[model samples]
Target: MPRFSANLGFLWKDIALPDAIRAAKRAGFEAVECHWPYDFSTDSVNQALNDTGLPMVGINTRLGINGIDDLGVCAMPGREAEAKGYIDEAIAYAVAIGCRNINAVAGKTGSTDEAEAVYRRNLAYACAEAAKHDKTIVIEPLSHRAAPGYHLSNVEKGLETIKAVGVANLKLMFDVFHVQVMQGDLIERLRATLPHIGHIQIAAVPDRGEPDQGEVNYPDLLAALDDMGWDGYVGAEYHPRGTMEQGLGWLKAYQ
Candidate 1:
């Protein structure tokens, strides 16, 4: 069976982040992931994970003051220094919390070519920094519809950027929801790109709701992952339909 990690970023929106870690544990999740953990005191969150025995699978790089389009400053020209600072902070936190994956976003802008160049340089630097902590760095492709002007908006671009960086620790954060929205053929694409993927995230397509409510057939999707011999975590990254408890029905089989 595939192991599922609750994405506390969306799963427990109703509680404090420290409390959310407990909630995910009580709800039967063995692991967790968050968009960013910098807002809360790192010590408190680390203690919670220790108490609950839930490994935090991943967290994202910080994107301060920049627009929603500017999530990953690393890819934005003129912000290389700012990006490195965020990377340094993220690496320190990941080491402190015992987490190993960091998702770096590529912010969108006017010139795709320039942004790609900047993204390549920044990702290469990030890969080197992450390797120091034995951490894996991932670049995710956001849906253009959800995030207009985002530079890394599709798997093709994401792959090209990864190649450009040419770092062993650098890989793609294969998000099913975004990929489904941007391009279909999840199985084919997943199979073709499985080796390049470092982590996976899922939710409903068209709507960011629970996997059960979306068009995605998660059972089949997960089964495919199982057959592919994927050993990484499958993050449940979705908004609840009602209470988070109600949204948990789909997870019983996997659990």
Candidate 2:
């Protein structure tokens, strides 16, 4: 079975982040990832991880003023300074907390050449800075339906950006939920992108809730990863239908 990581961003939204880390451990998760934990002190988060013996796997850069709609400023033209600042802050925090991966949010843009250029330049900077700390930077492609103008809205663009950056540590975050919504060919896509996949995440289709009721067969997907000899955490980044425990019936099989 594939190792699982609790995405504390969605799995335990009611409690403090440090407590959520402990909850993930109590719930039998091997590791944990978060959307944003900047509000909490690094010392506290690190203490929780050390206490639980669970590695904090990933965390996103600041979303800035536009929040989810802006996603991130890294790819937004005329916001290079702000984007780099977010990347710098994320890298510093990741190093402090022993997290290896940072999701550098590529803010929404009009798919213009200028925007693409800006994204590549900023990503190159992020990759270089992250390299100093032995960190990997990942870019996620949001579903066009859910995030219409996001810069990295499809796999092709994600791959292209990585290629343009031309760095070893820059990789793609293969979020199955969004990939399924944007492109139906998961297996082939995974195969093609496996070399550059830095992390994987899962959620139900359409609803973005528990994976058990989704159109995608998560067991088969996990099996596919196993078959490919891909040993990495499949992040459970889904919103619970009820309490987190109530929606975790599907996790028993995986665990």
Which candidate has the highest lDDT of all?
2
lDDT agreement with native, every candidate: 0.86, 0.91
User: Which stretches of model 2 miss by more than 4 angstroms?
Assistant: none
For model 1, the stretches where C-alpha displacement exceeds 4 angstroms are 67-69
- Residue 214 of model 2, lDDT score: 69
Predicted candidate 1 versus true structure: per-residue lDDT over 3-52, tens digit per residue: 88999889896788889999999999889999888878889999899999
Clashing pairs in 1: 108-149
What are the RMSD figures for all models against the true structure?
1.3, 0.9
lDDT of 2: 0.91
Q: Which window of ten consecutive residues has the lowest lDDT sum in model 1?
A: 63-72
